[model samples]
Target: MQETAYAKINLALHVRSRREDGYHELETLFAFVDRGDTLLAKRAEQDQLQVVGEFGGALDDPFGNIVMQALGSLPRPDGLAITLEKSLPVAAGLGGGSADAGALFRLVERAQGLPDDWRQRAAKLGADVPACVESVTCVGRGTGTDLEPIDSDLTGTPVLLVNPRVPLATGPVFKAWDDKDRGPMPEGTAREIAEAGRNDLRDPAISQCPVIAEVLAALGKSEAWKVEMSGSGATCFALFNDVEARDAAARAMPSDWWQMAGLLR
Candidate 1:
């Protein structure tokens, strides 16, 4: 079976407070884009994961991979060979890896009946895995594992994703987060993500990787409704009023950066 591991985009991320386990308490609106990696799994005698794509080499060890951790979570009666087509930029704050694990978990759940505590098991793979499993708009709280589904109607919303190709790790960015919070997102459905719904990681991420700012500025040059960095850094998205404008901006984007335009699902 094959599945598309959609990229996880943070429409708005707010780092609420630091937790006891050194992780930050966060509340962010999570959304998935059409652009992302693809996973193909098949039943085989020996189980193994073969990654093939631009950033596949970065994950040298498969054992320590989230995909492997997910398989370990549930007992597979039949060994399966999984191939990951790494299309999304790694560590670019698009949740490429987390989404991959989440996609695999879904595949496993269907192939082999997963446990009732599957959501928690998915969380064990990573904090973001649980939300990625659903691959929809959600409010991520606590360590980002505690999820509360939100009814967001972004049907015709045009979005353009641009990245400078710089991989910014989340750990350092969180450490660089300011003393003050970005305040919590007001309770309600966000048909259109408000400009006030800010991304707290922006400042620190920009401080570390200035190119991200440049991408944001590039997107700003266009007539977008709202433009901001997606997650930690690098990958910034511009929500245009329509798909035509968004696609035009994406096509005109500099070759130095990676860009993709699509209507939000």
Candidate 2:
């Protein structure tokens, strides 16, 4: 079986407060793009994984990869061989790993079924795993595990993702946060919320990787209805009104930078 690990982007992220558990209280809008890493799998006597593609080298330790952990967490009568095609950059705040694991979960689900405690198992893997399992637009809260599904207004909107070829880890960016409450997400449709809302991590991320600002600036030059940094850093996205405009913006981006254009899922 094969699955596409849909790319995740935060339409808007708000850091509510730092919890005693060391996780931040967050309110964010999660959206997925139609493009991302690809995972191919088949039944095997023992579980195995092979990583290949542009960003595959960064996740060379197969056993340590989240995809393996996701496989170990589930129950299967037979093992499976998973080949992960790493198209997305590592640590770019695109939820690349979580999306891969989620794709694996879906593949397992289709072949067999998920346990009743699937959500708990997914949360243990990563905060974003639960959301990525569904890969739909929703509102996430409390460390991004508490999810509330929303009727997204921005579905099918053309989007362009750009990266500065720099990997910014999530830890340092969170540490740099001012720790001020930015208030809750505004009440409105997905597009409306995205327009009025903001990514609280943008400034902190820019402090770690200044090129993020340049990416946002470049996307801002487009005719996008909304342009903002996704999740923590490095990868910023612009939501355009049409595919032609988005494609034009993609071509105009710096040749040295990496970019992908697709419609929102």
Best by TM-score: 2
TM-score of each: 0.95, 0.99
Worst 10 residues of 1 by lDDT: 187-196
Worst 10 residues of 2 by lDDT: 182-191
Q: How well does candidate 1 score on lDDT at residue 146?
A: 87
Model 1 over residues 1-265: C-alpha lDDT tens digits? 9998888888888888887889888888888887688999999886799999987988888998788878878887888899998888888888888999889888987897778899888887778889898898888888889898777777557888898888899889989987686578766566444466889899999999998888988888998988889889779998877888898888778998887676676
* CA-lDDT, candidates in order: 0.84, 0.94
- lDDT per residue as tens, model 2, 81-117: 9999999999998999999999999999999999999
Model 1 scores a C-alpha lDDT of 0.84
